[model samples]
Target: MQNVYLAATSATPEVDFRFDSHRMSLKGESYPENAQAFYGPLLDAVGSYLAACRGTTIQIDVQLAYFNSSSTKLLMSLFEQFNQAALAGNHVLVNWFHDEEDDTILEFGEEIAEDYPALELLTQALV
Candidate 1:
């Protein structure tokens, strides 16, 4: 499967995903006009890539300023996919970057960590 890379627009965040080498990242705000439409192919690509891996290491960096509830759900689903991949023995590393002043984002990261103990959840203030 090819890598998935979605560029950020005035209304969407950029997604830099590399599944072959297994280093993925999503950055910026995400409140797309249609959340499902925006995330559909992206999630499909991620799943396809994960299914092709055999003992691969996956790293994800999520840095978001804001996201709507729809996007939030989609992101959580995406993380769950990563969590499942880790459960199958794929080494997964996830670093959630939040601005120092954004307590909400930090807390959200913590909550995600709670849901997926198989993956490494790295929380650090964005510099």
Candidate 2:
């Protein structure tokens, strides 16, 4: 599958889904005017890639400083997809990076990890 990359904007984040390396990263903030419009295709691409992978390991790094409620939902949806892919025999690792001063983001990551027990989730506090 082809890789997907979107530059960060004032109201959006940078997405680098590197299919060749099996590594995906999303950084910066997310507060898009239309969350679905921004994330729909990205999620679809990820789903397609994961569906096609035959026991391939996928790694994801999420370094979001902040995200609106709508974006939070989209993030959860993506995590769920990853969880499903992991359950299907693929190894998925999700590294959630939160600012050291932000407990909310840490808790959010923890919540998603707890919700998707089958998926491997790593929460790291940024320096």
Number of the top lDDT candidate: 2
Model 2 lDDT tens row, 1-127: 8999999999999999999899999999999999999999998998998888879899999999999999999999999999998889989998999999999999999999999887889999999
Clashing pairs in 1: none
lDDT of prediction 1? 0.89
RMSD of each: 0.9, 0.7
Top candidate on TM-score is 2
Per-residue lDDT tens digits for candidate 1, residues 21-83, read 789999999989999999988989988888887788888998998988899889888989989
Q: What lDDT does the true structure give each of the candidates?
A: 0.89, 0.93
Candidate 2 differs from the real structure by a C-alpha RMSD in angstroms, to one decimal, of 0.7
Please give each candidate's TM-score: 0.95, 0.97
* Runs of candidate 2 exceeding 4 Å displacement: none
